[model samples]
Target: MFVRIVKMGFQPDKIDAFFENFEANKNQIRNFEGCLFLELYRDKNNTNQFFTYSYWEDEAALENYRKSDLFLKVWGETKVWFNQKPEAWSVDKVVSLE
Candidate 1:
């Protein structure tokens, strides 16, 4: 499987807005074709920082989603709330412990 991890830092005041948007759209993103799983995480000490971990069938699957209208809408609204540019990594699972 393909994995994607994205780190996002938002304006302190925009944290709640970002979370609300994620909650509203998580289902659609998870249900998108080739998506296997989706999850969100927040930093304990840095409340304004968040991370998204998702599993895709393959890199191409992820690329398709990135180019989709869903991404355009979500990212378009989301980028404005960022305090700094976001970061991301795409990788393959090396091993499984469970």
Candidate 2:
């Protein structure tokens, strides 16, 4: 499995709108091919900071999703609210307690 993490910092006033847009597109993103799991997280001390954690079957699968229309539509709108460039990482599991 491939794990993808994206950390984003949004303009303070745009946080709520960003979450609303994310919520609206969540299902569509989660349903994409090879998307095993998807989740959103908020920084404990920073309301305008968020992270997206997702699992895919592999890099190619993730790439396919990234290139899909669903991603284009969501990302196109989401980028407008960012206060800074988002950070992303793709990793493979080394160990899992569960």
In terms of lDDT, which candidate is strongest? 1
- RMSD of every prediction: 0.7, 0.8
Best by TM-score: 1
Q: Candidate 1, residues 1-98: lDDT per residue as tens digits?
A: 88999999999999888989998999999999999999999999998889999999999899999999999999999999999899999988999798
Provide the global lDDT of candidate 2 against the true structure.
Answer: 0.92
- Model 2, residue pairs in steric clash: none
List TM-scores for all candidates, in order. Answer: 0.97, 0.96
- Model 1 Cα shift for residue 59 (angstroms): 0.9
Off by over 4 Å in 2: none
In model 2, what is the error at residue 88, expressed in angstroms? Answer: 0.3
lDDT value, residue 58 of candidate 2: 94
